[model samples]
Target: MKKLVFVFAFFLCLAISAQDNYYTMYSFVVEPQNEATVYKLVEDYYSKNKPEGIYVRLFENHFKAEDMKATHSIVFLGTQEAVGNMYAGGGNVNFDLFITKLNQYIKDGAGSAMGKHIALNGDTSTRYPFQVYLLLDVADPDKYDAEHQKFHSKHNPPGMLVNMGNVIAGQGTGHYNRWAILGYKDMKSALGGPNQLLSGPALAARQKAWDAYRASNGGVEVVGSGMRVLLGAW
Candidate 1:
């Protein structure tokens, strides 16, 4: 099946220029018995030291590969430079402290990656309660982005915003090149399939656009997907 990957970039102003948004996502395979402890620790940590200019959200992978059981925390920063500062402990909060607390309950350390946002729609400010992530690989990034943006302009689903970003740093997962994050107002709105959200004509148009998008990009493949709920934010 051809995968549908969406896009989003960060909002930043540097030297009077807005920089492309960057993202750092940490995927953790928590020990099953320690899930509660891990969740509590994560929630508590964020509550106390909320980082600035970064949006932190957590998710449980509702659908994932059998070997990829995990919960993910995605941190959105405005610039690639910000990503470096964050990891190097230049941010307002103590990342080392956060990581120390995180290591105790995780099965493995964490799978981390960095990417740049390419496209975004709807209100990026409002916090949505649920989100779906589409990990994709595209043969041609430029063509894929053009077609996807065209599709979005004509057939966007109501109450849901789309974002796409390309992986630029972090562990290179050979299969994925970009990410599509679909934000929803609530879980109920999120569960509604695309067909249900759009009228017949709009849905058809979307499908056609997607087909063209796939063709132009030399075929897009969905390597992974996950559904997450909003956790406490700083």
Candidate 2:
């Protein structure tokens, strides 16, 4: 059977320039049994010490009823340099030195321990199971926009492309090693098929559309790689 070509869809900012903005998304997979404890700890951290480099947006995607524990928590960033700072304990702030910072936040009555929570960090090159996409260009951001509008547009997932002046970000690596988390709002949904397998003339059209969009816009540039944190809503 011929496979469908499904283009992954998401949006991001420009490269790692002094003025460049980067968005980071984080997925923390916590132990299911420690749901309340985990949420409390995470909430406490955000309240006292706001994450630097990127703005934090948190959510727990529950598939079955709300009874299920949070699968992961997500955060977005506005700059790559800012993120580097956060990972390194920005300013004189030293996360490594204050190892108990995270521990102290968790509600004490909760029996669960903080160490159980899974984290992907600088020392740990291991990446959490996630999908990533680089924002390229938009052909006609004004065109067919209303057709794509939805309820709760604020949380509306990132659009295919927007105005030319808008920024564009992509992974630094040539190969897309990140697993793509397909969603209802993605290009795969719009095209009504898989875009990954597209080839020959079809691929050419895809490239052309992106080129035209970039040209019409202010052109595209790098932001960050797939390994960096990135966030998207659907």
**Which candidate has the highest lDDT of all?**
1
- Residue-by-residue lDDT tens digits, candidate 1, 90-194: 433365566666676676534566667888876667776688888888777788888778777666777788888887555444578878888888877788855
TM-score of each: 0.75, 0.34
Compared with the true structure, what per-residue lDDT tens digits does model 2 show for residues 95-190? 332324443432232111001011111212222222333333333444323222221122222322211122233223232212212223243433
Over 4 Å off, model 1? 1-17, 74-76, 88-97, 171-174, 200-218
Report the C-alpha displacement of residue 57, candidate 1, in angstroms: 1.9
Alpha carbon lDDT of each predicted model: 0.67, 0.35
Q: RMSDs, each prediction? A: 6.8, 15.9
